[model samples]
Target: MVPERRRLLSRRWFYLLLLLPGLLFALPLAEEDLNAIRSVTDFYGQRAGKRMQAWRELIQRGKQQQWDEKRALTEVNRFFNQMKFLSDVVLWGKNDYWASPMEFIGAGGGDCEDYSIAKYFSLLELGLNDEKLRMVYVKSLTYQQFHMVVAYYPTPAAIPLILDNIDVAIKPATQRKDLVPVFSFNGSHLWLMKERGQGQLAGSSSRLTLWNDLRSRFSSEKLKRPKLNLDD
Candidate 1:
């Protein structure tokens, strides 16, 4: 039923009804999301051509599969994993940096957290409810390092399927014995993942400076699109 209702919502209607007219700030305002894509392209200059093409493909693909959550998840995960896995130190010369989806794509590579963040927003743009998706930070027991991945819950009680760049295959959280989830966050809320199932609120996600900065920039920026010619 949840999926069915989600399917009933058209992408155009979603942008017009939910986004344009000050209805609810449900998903980081569509304009900001679109602008981020442009901003990243502008920053990288010469290197952004490929990223721009990928961006077009991503958006076009999302429109094509907007109603199908499973297909959208599979494709977006695949799209981002193709990027090289570079650490924050190597990519941005920082110990830790939370990149916007466009920034992740613009650079052509990023760390685990960047992959998760980019996938999370891609899913959001594809019309998956924010409540059903999360960016989970986990401790990899195998590597003994902190890692991040996207988690999708079909229902509140159902097990989440992990979308990871490392594996390129979506697997249930229970099946991934190597990853011990520490916490999860979406646009609106944060959670502390427990051993039992699901998780509880940890705190406001606004506490994360990089996250706040990204969101702030997204909200303020504007993107310019090419003019459409109907008569041509």
Candidate 2:
């Protein structure tokens, strides 16, 4: 190969090399758990058809992307949002039930929070930075109801990208004028989203009863693959 072509190829390989450790760091899931997820999704695909196929494809896509953040976010967002938007009342007979990624895809239906939660974890599994991702609580002026969506901040000060089940297209927070952000959280810290870079620490995430419960369930489902985070 030409010297310039060789240098370019070397840089590409170097970047992929750097991506490897982060991918391992991001996926705390156990081998058995990953296998179990694969098996269950396989069964769903065979028996339930399209819904199950979507789940399987999501897993495959995550693995194939090899820690490409932009592609991972776009694919994961698209995968879960495609599911039918059924309320927790209709799906779980409760006003609110935070379904794990497995449970959400298994049922093939869920509300807005479910979509955001599933997308967050799936992106994490694909090695996207957890710091860049948040589950945002918002009030939907259009529907006049409390809602949830995933927000991706490429930089600390960049306008967040909104990943919503209700909207098929990914949009910047500025464009989504109809929805107002109240607060945001992830596996780490909960923030009082009053202004940019001015988030006050709310409290230990354990205070979020349902969020704590959901993370516990995720740990169990993943066969106790080491606690991700429980406190600051």
Candidate 3:
């Protein structure tokens, strides 16, 4: 009986030893994964903070400039002309979904969507009416993939003026049917352009949810880093 009891205790000790090495290895890997997640979160948070700061500054400057609609539109066009359109590097780079405008402004890089998004927010800050502006997502004719642009519609029935990085000139939306519209969103709303159709209001609940999400997620701080000649 004594011999049997001693053997059982010895077996339990052996099992404990076997488990120790595996746990030791797993701990480091777990720590590394946690650290990676933290790093990504921090990066996005910092970028968002920067974007918010930029928006504030831009708004203040716009107020000081006292630009009327015509002058503001001209300035916007000039600015678009100077900016290098979104590069493939910026398009493919993995980053946060809601990239603060500040990140784009800071890095001097962005994709088509980034340019449209930034411009849309900037125009809004400069006093462009929310109802008149939208960020349109579409399938590009040349690239055969998703792309985006800001469209300005003066009236409900009027064709929108396209603000695109692919072309320097602002053209009528009707002329660009090659761009199949997927959806359109703005600072305050989202539209199911292809299905619900353009000019019709989206569901209030959906619009409110979208508006809140965008408001909370997007930041204009990157613009504050330093003014780059954003003129196209």
Candidate 4:
């Protein structure tokens, strides 16, 4: 009887050992997933500071230039254009490429995507409706790897005007098929792969599950990191 009891105990221990391997494998994957989400959150949170500054600048620029919709877009274009192409190149290569507008303004520099994001939020502050704007990720005809730009859609199904670092002219989206749209997102929603979808289908996904985490990081506390002279 004692030997049978001992055999049963041994089998219990073997089963427990089998469970350990699965737990070990799952632990790292869980951490990696969490880290990826955290990275996105960190990116947006850092930009919050720059976003605020950009908005303030926009307000001043509007007052100075008698801001209207067309002028606002032009002024935004001009502001980004002044940075030239080099900034965009550097920003793209850096693993820490772009920050939120708040972080970007505080840092004083960012890649093309950063400029686009800044302008998007600035337009929002200026009372541009969310439906009219999208931050689009695209493939550049000339450059390798993914690139980002803003597409302003004045109405649903209307062609969008592309704001690009490579060119100053704001052209229609259809004019450039070189830019195969990977995804389009606005301030409130991230559209997977395309812009059109039902409202009920908009928010359900593990992909966008990181948004709340990203949003929380945008609080003022995160923006208080000691400012660096990003111009350098």
- TM-score leader: 1
In Å, residue 113's CA in model 4 sits off its true spot by 2.3
Q: Candidate 2: how many backbone clashes?
A: 0
lDDT of 3 by residue, 1-232 (tens): 6997896675455434433433443322234334433443344443332333333443444556678755655555545333345554444344423334544543445667667767777787688898888888788887898888888888876788888888757878877766878778775566767532374557542454434544565432222222232211
Q: Write the per-residue lDDT of candidate 4 for residues 5-76, one digit (tens) a residue.
A: 896675455434433433433322234334433443454443333333333544444655567777777767
RMSD of 2: 13.4
lDDT for residue 228 in candidate 3, whole number 0-100: 30
Write down the lDDT that model 4 would get. Answer: 0.57
In model 4, which runs have C-alpha deviations exceeding 4 angstroms? 1-55, 61-66, 84-98, 194-217, 224-230
Task: Mark the regions of model 3 whose C-alpha exceeds 4 Å error after superposition.
Answer: 1-62, 85-92, 195-214, 217-232
lDDT of the candidates, in the order given? 0.70, 0.70, 0.57, 0.57
lDDT of 2 by residue, 72-179 (tens): 777777667656678787677788889887677666567898899989888887777888988988899999999999999898778888899888799888889888
Candidate 3's TM-score: 0.59
Error of 1 at 119 (Å): 0.4
Q: Candidate 4, which ten residues in sequence have the lowest lDDT sum?
A: 196-205
